[model samples]
Target: MEIQKTPLKDCFILKPDVFRDDRGLFYETYNQKVFEKITGLKIDFVQDNQSVSSKGVLRGLHFQNGEMVQAKLVRVVKGKVLDIVVDIRKDSETFGRSFSIILDDVEHLQLFVPKGFAHGFITLSEQSIFSYKCDNYYDKASECGIIYNDATLALDWHLPKEEFIISAKDLELPSFEEAIS
Candidate 1:
């Protein structure tokens, strides 16, 4: 497995060594020792979540701030998606900056979105299954997000604005300017 850094501070892209054969394929998705050795940060994931979305569906720019910060390892399981992460740590050099990547079943690539970043994805295929591991347990009070189409962030979700199928809750979230710092 190789853990590569992303443009944002404390975040990374992890690529596992996939072995293929006549039967099928195999790979190790998580190994605590190797991850800590490579990134120098120890994580104890407490939750695993998965969601299915159709093409043109946009999920988030969500974060858990305050006392219950959550870092995530996100990947595509069945199809393809445009994954986006935004740095929200006020003291970091890359604060407010965003990074985008293509995460699909074919590549089996993963993104490590650290505690202080907002994470989200847009489905690019007919149907996509997205999975993630979270370092901390859920805290409803601390969960919040910047609206996906925040003008300041200027995220290009691949699909046009009118094409998106967003949730009513997501639509009601604050813009970047109003997001928690």
Candidate 2:
């Protein structure tokens, strides 16, 4: 796998070597050795989560606070999505900065979002199957989110504002300023 670091610290885009044949293809999606070599951080993913969403569906801008903060390894299995991560660590140099990438089954690429960042995605195809590994388990009380379309963040989701569809909870999420205040 080729791990490419994004502008945001600790965020990575991994391109796996896919071996194709007349039947299908295979690739080593995750290997601890390679991961450590690339990121210099050792992670032991304790939980795996999967979700299915239709086009126009947007999931998050979510993260956990306190000790439950998580690092995620995310990929798309059946379709495509616009995955995004925002650095929220108050002490980090790149705080408030965000990164976005296109993850698709055909590319077999994965995204690694370290703890202290907010993670989210928007399905780009009719249907998308998303999977991820988290270093920590879910902690509802510690979970928090920023509005996906927060003006200060100024994210260009590649979709028009009127066309972007999101859940009621996400829509009700506070802006970055509001949340921080």
RMSD in order of candidates: 0.9, 1.0
Question: What is the per-residue lDDT of model 2 for residues 98-139, given as tens digits with 9 covering 90 to 100?
Answer: 999999999999999999998899988989999999999999
Pairs of colliding residues, candidate 2: none
**Angstrom error at residue 25, model 2:** 0.6
Query: Which ten residues in a row are the worst by lDDT in model 2?
Result: 156-165
Q: Per-model C-alpha lDDT, please?
A: 0.92, 0.91
Best by lDDT: 1
Candidate 2 lDDT at 89 equals 86
lDDT (C-alpha) at residue 94 in model 2: 92
Residues 1-181, candidate 1: write the lDDT tens digits.
9999987888899999999999989998888899999999999999999999999899998998788999999999999999999998888999989999999999899998888899899999999999999989889898899999898998999988888999998999898878954
lDDT of 1 at 165: 94
Task: Tell me how far candidate 1 lies from the true structure as C-alpha RMSD in angstroms.
Answer: 0.9
